[model samples]
Structures are given as C-alpha cells and as structure tokens.
Target: MFRKEYTRIESSTQHSSVNEFVVINIPEEDVEPKQIILDPDDQPMWESAKIVAPTPNSAIIQLDVDDNFVINSTHLKMILENKFDGYLRADPHDHIREFLAICDMFKYGEMHSEVVKLLIFPFFLCDKAKTWFNELNEESIISWEQMRRAFINRFFPPSLFNRLLLEIRNFSQNICESLTEDWLRLKNMLQKCHGHSLAKGVIIQIF
Candidate 1:
C-alpha cells in the first residue's frame, strides 16, 4: 500500500501564500494493487444491485379442484391445438361456444364441468389473447362463469354490442339475396354478437 503525506508551507513573499506538498511513500518490494471481486451469489443484503429474488409462479386463474384432479396432458394438447389469438375478425362468442363444446366432450368422473372448463380455457389462447388473460388480476378468475363473463366483456365491449344491435335492427334482405340466405346472414350476425337478448317476435318483425 502507498501512503500519502501532505505538508503546508508558507512562502516568505510580500503576499504570503500557503502551498500544499504531498509525498507518496512506496514500499521497497514491487507490489500490484489488489483487485477485489464479489461473487454474484454473495451480494450484500442491502445492495440494490443484488440479484432479484426469483418471481413466484403466480397464475391468473385459480383452480379449486381436488388434489387428485390432475390435468390430462392429452386433453390440454387437444384444446391448445387450436389457439385463439384475439384477432379483430375472430369472434369471441364463437370461440367460447367451441371451447365449451370441446370441454363438454370430455368426462372427468366426479370433477365439475366448471372446473374442467376453467382449467382448459387458458391453454386455448395465444398471442394477444394470452397477453390479455395474463394481464388480468392474479387468481381473479376462479369459476367458469366468471371467466366466461370476463372474456366476453374484454373482447366484446359495449361499443361493439351497440353496433351489432344497430346492425341487427336494420337487417334487410339485399335485392339479389334469397330469403334463406338473408335469414342465415341475420342468424350469423346474432351468433357473432352474443347476449343480443332481442325477442324472437321483434326479430321476426324486424325481418
């Protein structure tokens, strides 16, 4: 280690000025300055730069199934084989309908149908849909009904509902469209917008 010593000396001039003199003392032996390295794992407890604690594996949806209720990988694979990425043209109502249909085909003995649907629902989403699901409050959705409502509310907003309602109200057969084709078109539109709640009599009257 090199030691530094400082001395103050006053100049004997008309205007006295104090000058600082520093003397550095070096050891006789040739020595290099020691370099200290800190192990990444041994970071100081108070250090802000310390490695962040590993994030807990939190899920958006909570499953209240029994301990024995194991998720079947085969079912998961089958459900995820077709992913919904929340595209602008993709119908969320149709996606939910298809998802429920797929869930209905599977039988899990004593497990409730809600449990089965809730467990398998997340696997069928990708890209933007998956991102939206993840951004939902942690474990906020625990039931199939709640999940369904949330999904519908997120994808099918009020503006879209109003627009679809207007379209359904103003539904008219085109000059070249047949009665069968026009009826099918109106049915398809209604299907696209779930919970239209328009009475059958009113729908018929509108047509």
Candidate 2:
C-alpha cells in the first residue's frame, strides 16, 4: 500500500484551559477507494462555497428557503416562478438552519462544522428525499417512523392504506423511545412536506 493507513485527528482546546483530540487511523487498501469513502459521501455536506444563490438567481443551493428563511426575491421568483405557495413551502427547518450557517460564514468568514451532521443523515437513505437531503444536517434528524410514514404516504396508493397504517403504527412503536411529541412533529412535518417532485424541472420551464 502506498499509504499504510488514513489517520484522523480531532481536538478541542478553544476555552484556553485544555485541548482535546481524537484520531482514527484506518487501514487503507487502495488510495482511490479511501478517497471515495472520504469524498463527502458523494453527497451535499453544506459548505459556504456550495451556497449558489450568492445574491439569488445565480445558481442553485440544494435546500429550499421559505418563511423560516428568505432568499433573494429575484432568486425565489426565478426558482418558484413567482407563485410561491406559502410558508408551507418554507424551506425545510433543518435546511434553513444549514443555509443560515453558510450565510453566517459568508458574512463573518468563519467555518462551523457543528451542523455537518445536519447535512448527512437524510441522504443516508437515497430512495426518498431524492439526492438533496444532506445539503445541511446541523440537526441530526432521525425519525424512522416519520420516514416510513412519508414513504408509504407518498408511494402507497389508497389500495395499500391499511398496510401503510400498520407499518406506521409499528414504526411509531419501535421509535417510542423518542418523545411522542417529537415523533408526531416529524410525522406531521413530513405529512406537510411536498414530495420530491416539487422542484425538479428545467429552470427555463418555470421562467
């Protein structure tokens, strides 16, 4: 092996009292494979550089922005075609948080990876939420039941209603360890979120 192993070191000493570091050294077989495994998972791990809507109407930032946050009106109109449904279209809460972090970094020129978790978990499963869920993961949101219910709700036709309900109920039971309120919130939130088809279209089509 050209490189014997990959090493990771983590440290925290900002308080000026003490510093801490954790390093993981993994045996690497091939440079290419190691790089593949480390290339941000071929997913959106929100970086300030990835913020495409610089002043809006420029490029696309993966997360949706809405009542919780506002993008430049020009960009909003460009993407949504001026017929914004409402705050219901508010960029998903977690997404807004990530973008705001990027905005902060842009304004202040600081980097915060604290929410990188917010950018990774959703795309942890690629079948749903399409490919953009991880643009930000400041909040590590994992409500398997919510995801299950959402999947069934979107993919299950009326014919599978009973099975869908059963699956949801079972998911709720398994995830009871989390507070009922949080799970319900996630379920309700997912219930309100539009399906992945919301914005995947040619920009010119909307314009």
Candidate 3:
C-alpha cells in the first residue's frame, strides 16, 4: 500500500522541475527511499536534481541530466512547499529598510531559517551582499543564526551606531532649510539613534 502511494506521487512529480513525497505508515525497512528534490526554479540549474547527501542544514543534489549543486535545507523546503511566492524580491542595498521589515515579519512568523535563505538568494541580495556571500565558504555556515549575524555585520556594521550618534550630536537647522523639514529630519534621526534617553538639556540644545 505504501509503495503504491509512493509510486503514484513519484509518477505525478516526474514531469515537474521539483518534487516531494510525504511518507506515511510505511515500515522503515519496507519504505522505498525517494531522494529529496531541490526545486530548480529557485536557482538557475542546468537540470533537475535528486538529493545525494545531506549535511546539517544543506544538501548535495545530483542533477538528472548531469551536474551537482548544494542547496540549503530551508530553501529546499520553501521551494517544495511553494512558500517563496509573493516575496517582495528587492535589492538589499537600495531597499535595506524594506528587506529588514520583511526579515522581521518572517522572524515574527518563526521562519528565521527562511529569512536567511531569502536574503542570500542571488535575486534578493544586493551587489555588495552578493560579493560578500560568494566569498564565504558555504559549508562553513552551519546554522541560520550564523548566516543572519554575518549578513547584519556586513550591511549594518557597528560603525553605523557611531555615525548615527555623530549625526544626532551635530544636528542643526541649516540656514536655507525650512524649520519644519529640519525638525522632521532631526526627529527621524533621533528615532534611529534611540535618543529618548538623552538629557532634556541636550535635546533643547539641539533644537
């Protein structure tokens, strides 16, 4: 019965570029192991593939026609489930705030692993981030947490805090700037700098 079900799923999925079979009720020994398929649409590939080996949060897949590729587990899962649909797909550099908001949304949904995967995808990563990502040895990254930290460190280095602090300290109304525009700019920067804790005297001096 299990084999029959598995064969049916497999036959239906063969024509598709990616495939998955949900195993159920089969005894461990009797189950015909089907290699996991990493969707080719997620990344450009010469051919479709079947998982040859899995390590931690990634897998090595051999293509049907010929070739091999390594893909992260979270990415493979998302591809199989069609969860990558409707993503904002912005360039990370030009749309840092937008990408960060998307990341936060995913984190709130408890999909941290998927967040890292989405950020690192070539289509989503900015030119600078793509260069950095290409330089790293993919196998060395063992977890989503490490990937997230590396990405943040690359784009939002600790130096940003210092820059923000300097901006806030030196903020002043320019002679040619409208008072309303200046005040709004200062308020926004202060929010970024989290300046609510600054003394009232300092705030007054800036104003």
Each model's lDDT: 0.72, 0.34, 0.50
Put down candidate 3 lDDT per residue, 82-118, tens digits, no spaces. 3222222422233444544444443323434454444
Tell me, what's the RMSD of every candidate?
A: 11.7, 23.3, 18.1
Winner by TM-score? 1
Q: Judged by lDDT, which candidate is best?
A: 1
The residue-by-residue lDDT of candidate 1 on 1-207, one tens digit each, is: 543333322222122122322222324446543222223334345553657786534244555668777767777777888778997887888888788777767778755677787777878899999988877777787677888888888888999999999999998999999999999999998887778899999989988
lDDT of 2 by residue, 113-172 (tens): 322222222332332343323332333333433433443344444544454344433443
- Candidate 3 error regions (>4 Å): 1-97, 100-122, 191-205
Poorest lDDT segment (10 consecutive residues) of candidate 2: 9-18
Cα error, candidate 2, residue 114 (Å): 19
lDDT of 3: 0.50
The local lDDT score (0 to 100) that residue 15 gets in candidate 1 is: 25
Which should have the higher lDDT, number 1 or number 2? 1
Report how far residue 68 has shifted in candidate 1, in Å: 4.9
C-alpha root-mean-square deviation, candidate 3:
18.1
TM-score for all models, in order of appearance: 0.67, 0.16, 0.42
